[model samples]
Target: MPSAPGTGKGGGPDHGYPPVGRLLPVGGGVVHALTTGSGPDVVLLHGASGNLRDFTFDLVGRLARDFRVTAFDRPGLGHSDPLHADGESPAEQAAVLDAAAGMLGLGRAVIVGHSFGGSVAMAWALEHPERVAAVVTLAGATMPWPGDLGPWYRIASTTFGAATVVPLVSGWLPDSYARNSVASIFAPQQPPDGYLEHVGIPLTLRRAAVLRSNVRQVAGLKPHVAAMARRYPGLSIPVEIVHGTADTIVPAAVHAHPMSRLLPNARLTKLPGIGHMPHHVAPDATLAAIRSAAVRAGLN
Candidate 1:
């Protein structure tokens, strides 16, 4: 197999990545990104354990008709290089992606983030308010939550896990478990058809760099939000947030509702009985939110 551009966690060729997407040079390492569409730019940030393909599966195609949709693989996941070992915060990822967007020639576009990507999107808008035309967070985790991310993440976040557990799973993790894990995120809402193949499950699973970075990001999310959440009120740009009531992963009540209350210029749309994967389960609703924000910010 051909070598992927970015270095893997163990300092080896990123064979896990296929020869798709562009390798964008930014910061100290390169980030992988894909662009589509023909109008105003819309920057897409995928959640943890995801790549640009998540949007490419459906959302990118839908939005490409009206907007320039650019999707990025979060650093260390998919084909992007891992940030510095200490760089686990949303702010860190946001910085890298922001630089990439500028390099890719995306200017003053609507920033859309889903799940953990929401956190990064919030950071991006906060840190670079001048660059963001508007913000759309889909079931994003912007508020602090109680408890840890269960056993898998708990273990993956540890020093021992990084050295031992991560490599074990990366090398031998079964396809069944990986498939089910992806499906579980959608829960009551099935992952539609052919999501797994389009999503590049093995790339996400087999990359130790991504595994360590994701779990560490999750482990440190609460405090990270605590530091960043206070900055929401400072944002004067239009912000649209959509979250599902049935989302067990990042409940609307736990994140979106309260966060909406905090933003000075933001509105939250509550999707009743919808699960965590709102972008997949409720694309129309998600699209509507993006359109609304674009209109409010006059990006159209």
Candidate 2:
């Protein structure tokens, strides 16, 4: 099954900026995505267990003002179909993204990737340097998978492999399961209402293929980060990393800290009292970091 277009309503048109919606077919599946506003291109990638909409709504709208904001549902998430085979690794996903960019007439784009999306964007930039104008990673995981996993996580991963069974067993999962899961990623502060309902449930239900591919990608992170780190010194483009000091999902010490140290020209921003999903918890700060990176890239 190829990726498909998004079926839900996107943001309404504002100030004559046409509402953006599209489903571009690439390879076996179609990639559901949207493009809004106009100028230099900026591609937004969502993290694990999330779709493009995971970005704070206001942030997306704000970014669309300066750059042609492009966001998409990865394979098997939202309206996009999952990978048809086991070959849909991070590198392969990057290839699809490159093809999508070409199809969209974006020759070069500033890639703003969140969490796992950051990994994808980095891999894409590494593979096709010419197509990337700059790179920004938000709470990205750029390290090896953790050796220790609680029993629940192990079980969840195993069950996610058999996600076809999720609908059948969703009843057994507590109502607060998804909400609590996302809440744990942040500090003690509660996230916006409907956060999990809007972002989490649909993802778990719609993104089985991507979830499976992520298992493999997570396992391969160490080598990938190491290889990419070696290439960073060769990169002249601007790279910015934003992470939360209190992030529990992808620890700052293990992921962002090492990444910031390795990349020769990288700038790192650590948000106080923030957590994994900084884009949601601190949209203003995230947007500021993005604007700063864009300025550094001479796109602003």
Question: Which lDDT tens digits does candidate 2 get at residues 132-194?
Answer: 878889998665555754553344445454464433444355666666676776665677876
In candidate 1, position 258 carries an lDDT of 86
| Model 2 alpha-carbon drift over 4 Å, by segment | 1-20, 145-172, 206-223
Q: After superposition, how far is residue 135 of candidate 2 from its true place, in Å?
A: 0.7
- Superpose all Cα atoms of candidate 2 onto the true structure and report the RMSD in Å to 1 decimal: 5.4
lDDT at residue 7 of model 2 (Cα atoms):
32
lDDT of 1 by residue, 278-299 (tens): 8898999999998888899888
In model 2, what lDDT does residue 150 have?
52
CA lDDT, candidate 2, residue 34: 81
